[model samples]
Target: MLQTQSNKSSFFVKRPILFVIVVEVLLLIIVTVGGAIATIKELDYIAAIWVSFTPIALILVIYLTWKRKWGSLGFQSLSTITKQNWLYHLPLILVLITISLKGFEDLSVSKVIQFVSFTLLVGFVEETVYRGLILKAMLNVGVKAAVITSSLLFAVTHALNMISGQDLANTVVQIVYSLLIGVVLALLMVRGSNIYPLILFHFLHNLIQFLGPEATGVTYFDVIALVILVIYSIVLIKSLNKKTIKGSIAA
Candidate 1:
């Protein structure tokens, strides 16, 4: 057992990307099989399966195979919020406004609990895997490359939703939107040096989407909201870049 564990550790250290890919494939298999079983049985257990299994698998892999610290995987305690850190709040503001506009109605306690739990799980798992492990692994190449590569991977992973019977057009939109969101969250993680806020924002965004009023079809409002968010993210990234350059010069 010890020799086998050592070999696994060495393998992951030598090929972190491959490790991530293998773990992701495992997750996809688990979700696909679990979801199919749930559908066949008419049970609402997909969220529970994903929420429980993905994180546990990721934690075990990171702990046993990779030997990485949890803090390195974005499990750090909250940091002090400065002006720079405060900009990370923009996404949360947008989420809240969108939810308000959608006019949330009261939900049963059980449904609310389910929505919140699933969103929080998604936020934790995705950030830890993509922004935490993958982004950190790629940083030796360059920060820009790391951010872009991780964000793209994050977006592409949404294609799995298609296998779960999501509409193709909607899934495409989700993929694009996820790319944008990933970039923004990645920058925020860099700026804040903490991933807790990103997890919270991600959870809030998903919760809003889940509980807020559903749209009948694509609307102008959705386009406008997306545009505003993209613009905000661009400005935020530029601002953070400027700060970094100035700090480097002063140092």
Candidate 2:
């Protein structure tokens, strides 16, 4: 009798969790196939389009789920998390400034344009996938558990990317950096209840990193600075929780 009861409890806990995992796996598979095809065809632009389309598809899925009134399926609580705070944008700006300064020496008009495009593509794709879809789906499991689970998953995702082409030390270091940023993004989503701030910071982060001529070795230091920024944002949020999400939501 006790064993049966325990099994039932486990089933309940695992059910919703499995749904999100399945969705993520599906997405990864799709992207992998697209990437392979792009490689075979030697079409970098096709690959870029394929990569950029994933987030757009995910956002549409989320919107459709919400419209259909499907309960907690694939980022369904968009309405619940639209609240905003002006203070949230402050950290975003500071983070952007710091990152931009590092990359400024290599700045040129063409580089700026490329950086802008990269920022929008990567920022939107990742924010939608990581914070928006993953977090919302995990929330269906439980709030606290969602945050911790998604944070770890976000960090681990970076590890796979790092292993593909990046150095071993950088990959390990990125795992740590990814977790810190993951926590910050998750917390911002919860506290600000909006996606814009996270999106902005993500865009700026990538823009700075990719635009610069700085060597890959120096990126370790950049990660260190990023971690500090995350810590500072947390402290600031704690001190004035009310101001953290003041004017962020769209009508």
Candidate 3:
């Protein structure tokens, strides 16, 4: 039997735009305050991330328990990935390849454990919220609007780094790069309707970047990567728009 959502008349269900805004604000406060506390305590980055996102994840878990709409939010198994949408999968693969270029700087047991735990938590929390919850809610607006709005908000969330003392220039670049990646991930969620692969890839990508030698500063490769992602995002938006429009007409 199909388990329908119990809260059909709830405020969030009726006001998805407002729901998105509230969620964004809640995440920003939770994450930013956690990061700030970690900094003040001189804690490790791992602790900072765990402190910040773990609560958010648990809250979503509670919501899922109440609603039981896991599949609707793209939390299905990996087998649900649409093998037919091969092109939609390439951008994330390419980004993963780019991230893997960063060679490992540590391989100790504790470090590896931290790497796995940290990356998994980061990937799961972020992918679940941004691509799963936010994107799904924004879809009530329209495909293009959902993609653009969620992606832009995802990028904006990175501004929290500036509060933690990251340099202005690097933070700006990160925001832009995150926005492009957001677009790719959002498109994948909509077309493929599966998020397991996204969570896995995000885990690996972050792990690889952490493994690699720390950059002295942003390099030419960063610029190249950003430009490539921008072009790919544009092509995807155009292609997706055309297909969705055609489908709407046929319906």
Could you tell me how far off, in angstroms, the CA of residue 163 lies in candidate 3 after the best superposition? 2.6
- Give residue 139's error in model 1 in angstroms: 1.4
Give per-residue CA lDDT, model 1, range 204-223, as digits (tens). Answer: 88788778777455555566
Clashing residue pairs, backbone N/CA/C < 3 A, model 1: none
- What ranges in model 1 sit over 4 Å off? 1-14, 45-68, 240-251
Native-to-model Cα distance after best TM-score fit, residue 202 in candidate 1, in Å: 1.1
Put down candidate 3 lDDT per residue, 1-251, tens digits, no spaces: 12245545555557889989999889889987998899999989889889898898899889977877577677777665556665577776777676566556867889888888999988998888888878877676677777888889988887667876888899989898898889988876776667788788789878887877886667766777787788777777666655653332221
Q: Backbone clashes per model, in order?
A: 0, 6, 0
Winner of 2 and 3 under lDDT:
3
Best by lDDT: 3
Quote model 1's TM-score: 0.78
The digit string of per-residue lDDT tens for model 2 on 1-251 reads 01233433443235757856865676667666766677777777434555645556666557646444122222333454533445555666665666566545557798688668766776776677677657765654555665677788778767776645877877777787778778777766756556765776787787677766655664644665676767764764474443432321110
**What is the Cα-based lDDT of residue 152 in candidate 1?**
89
lDDT, candidates in the order shown: 0.66, 0.61, 0.77
Reference-based lDDT, residue 243, model 1: 58
Q: What is the TM-score of each candidate against the true structure?
A: 0.78, 0.70, 0.87
Which residue pairs show collisions in model 3?
none
Candidates ranked, most accurate by TM-score first: 3, 1, 2
